[model samples]
Target: SDQISKDESMVGFVDDLQFFIDNRDGETVVGLKQKLEICGRGAAFNDAKKKKELFAKLLMRFERFSSAQQLFAYIMAAIHETFDTKIIPSTSSLSTQEIDAMIEAEIVDKIMAEIGEGSDHMTLNRTHIKGMIYWLADKCYVRWHCD
Candidate 1:
């Protein structure tokens, strides 16, 4: 059995955002390894059921987290789920407002401020968020795995 919790496993799937044990799964959540290989990315859904299901479940699961690592996992998962190139939803629940808010609440605004005003070509975007989440997840996952 893996010593790492499910949430830790989620890190590989998602990042450094904080997470903790939750009653929902009756144990620590799992982590991810390199971002979830979401199929179809964001697209259009065949029915409303799937749309509502993912939206509610995913968001609820995220609400259970207490730290950044956990939140990062959700963000990364969102990115993977919404990539739209490799694997996109037939109909995605994600919206610009929702995405922006999530990014702002969990990462974007913080990262932007932390980067400072030195000026550079790179700016906030899916790619930037992707890298940050991966790097952070990798670090936290390693720690949990090693311990």
Candidate 2:
């Protein structure tokens, strides 16, 4: 059952990636590329070889599109999976940094809510919550703030 669930998730991810690749514009692709590069650099000291492999796969997949659409899709999917939010705010009104921060906050809020719900009287420590937020942020390539 777990394997089946994992397979289904992979299929969904691929479908989302294809949709993004087909629909994304140059600006979105550039932004995703920048984020992916940042993620790659951040991982170098901890797991250089794995990070290199992952980045190589990402770059190769990115080459299939005009730009980094796959990476964008992956990041968006990660955010949605973490926060249960599918809305990516339009860049027309908000700057990229603002949008990123908004998404990060939403993710953190969702995580905190889940942790609270799963605990007795929300007894989980601040450090644990912060750790989970940071882990999710790293996985999604988002900038997280405890504030």
Candidate 3:
């Protein structure tokens, strides 16, 4: 994804990510897992192996960025929030485009800010955000339909 903006505060992005990874306590890890489980099952992809492969590719892309962990967390939180406050309550499935729009509305600005602060040259765009969302859906971190 192309960068939306840049900022000087991003100088220490690498350090911040290292610190985040190094200091990941059990609570934090559990919270991530819980977020993933909140929506029960995902129906985006029916083939488990294919989903795993796609997730692996996305993980590779995520690792190349300085604020990988934070970006992942933000998207996960946004997905969970979207499902909890929107999709699940509606008790109906949303088209992928609709889900993408909702998720993007919630995170794009925040993510742009974080991305600016997370790297000097690396950037993220809607495509990358959607990729992350799709991977999460495939992994059962969020759902498009109520279960």
Candidate 4:
């Protein structure tokens, strides 16, 4: 059974490659590798919907074919954003604005701490930070458009 499952997975991977080659113009072997890397990281997400959404975005971005390292960075960022928001209180005594700020700070600090171990790119803009927060909220990690 395990051998059969492995064979099935291999067949599925081959089918994915065929689909990519047929549809994505200008995609190269390197692009496929990047896609695989992105897909592998995205598969770690526990939520299927979020995983699909994330892979869609990653695939769109993969056309440009940046390093797999960058894709990994985004994956880590998403994981951190989702995990952090999931732990935040859904209903807080603080004002919505205050809670939003706190969430942002917590995310930034966590991302920084994780990345600080090696990477130099520690800065996240307000818009990007807000986008992560909104993404988490949309995933039901917190109240949407509330704190």
Question: Model 3 off-target regions past 4 Å?
Answer: 1-58, 61-66, 91-100, 107-110, 113-118
The collision pairs in model 4 are none
Ranking by TM-score: 3, 4, 2, 1
lDDT of each: 0.35, 0.39, 0.49, 0.39
Predicted candidate 2 versus true structure: per-residue lDDT over 33-146, tens digit per residue: 344354343333344334434544543443434223343354445554544333232434556476556655665455545445332211333333333323333444333211
In terms of lDDT, which candidate is stronger, 1 or 4? 4
| 1-147: candidate 4 lDDT, tens digit per residue | 232223322222233222322332333323222332342423423443444455445434433333322533463345444545643444244554665466555665655555544323223333344444334333333232222
Q: What TM-score against the true fold does each predicted structure earn?
A: 0.24, 0.28, 0.47, 0.35
lDDT minimum window of 10 residues, candidate 2: 3-12
TM-score of 4: 0.35
lDDT of candidate 4? 0.39
lDDT (Cα, 0-100) at 102 in candidate 1: 56
Best-first order by lDDT: 3, 2, 4, 1
Q: For candidate 4, which ten residues in a row score worst on lDDT?
A: 8-17
Superposed on all Cα atoms, model 4 deviates from the true structure by an RMSD in Å of 15.5
TM-score of 2: 0.28
Runs of candidate 4 with Cα error greater than 4 angstroms are: 1-59, 63-87, 116-126, 144-147
Identify the leading candidate in terms of lDDT: 3
**Residue 129 in candidate 2 has what lDDT?**
37
